[model samples]
Target: MSSMKKRMIKGMVRWSVLPADCILNSCIINIYKEGDYIPPHIDHHDFVRPFCIFMSKGNIIFGKEIYFVGLSEFRGSVTIPLPVGSVLILKGNGADLAKHYIPRVPWHKVLVTLRRMDHSKIPYGFQSDLELEELRLYEL
Candidate 1:
């Protein structure tokens, strides 16, 4: 609908696995300081399409399993070392069936997240100039 939306959608279609018709109505930028952690949970929002997490700095360990005693035990859970400029896309089986979280970051971290929103969930007064052309320069 908006110029930014059009650009992002076009970029995703060309550069990512996002469907050609996928429509992302919103984007989120998150910053996490050292010692920060997000509890594991399912992102079952209907408006949200497959989410993408792009790391700008620091390292993180994703996917912590929940223990019976009401705690996170990342014993054998896969640990992904996200160096700066790493992008992790969440989709398909892993996105729908499992919960994932980032444990405390050893250093500051920044995340650029894009979420495709259904019409009803689009945030009001949101606008951006997403440079679709830049997608061509990015190494997928």
Candidate 2:
């Protein structure tokens, strides 16, 4: 599918859950090629909550590509083998507070991929219009 079409789909997901006062801020859907991986890093954005949904899976090694380096760091790194239909719910602090990356494993290095299903596509009456913009400003 085209990137824009994909983006629109992602946007629909985002808008569906957005609060009435929030704006349909930022939505991203990423695809990682085989042998490709995202480096360990933290999100440098201002968002109340940041959530991710695994749309598809292609040999993934979760939690192996992260190193906590702050007060909120977890005791140890987590290596979860995420399967299709799995949902990863993360708060802004949880996602941004710690550093994470795709680990380099001997077996394929695990291609990590997921889509952001934001909350901004609900019909009227689901939430207040004012809250929509407020909610969208932060990570969904």
Reference-based lDDT, residue 101, model 1: 68
In candidate 1, what are the lDDT values of residues 1-140, reduced to their tens digit? 45654665576667655654454555666788877766666666764557766777543443435432234334325666776767676777557766666666667777766766665665677653345423432355
Q: Please, what are the lDDT tens digits per residue for candidate 2 over residues 1-140?
A: 34543453345346564233333344455555544555656654443344443434433223434545543333225555556545554445556565554433333322222223244544455532332333332255
Worst 10 residues of 1 by lDDT: 67-76
Cα lDDT for residue 47, model 1? 48
RMSD of each: 5.4, 10.2
Q: What is the clash count of model 2?
A: 32
TM-score of each: 0.66, 0.44
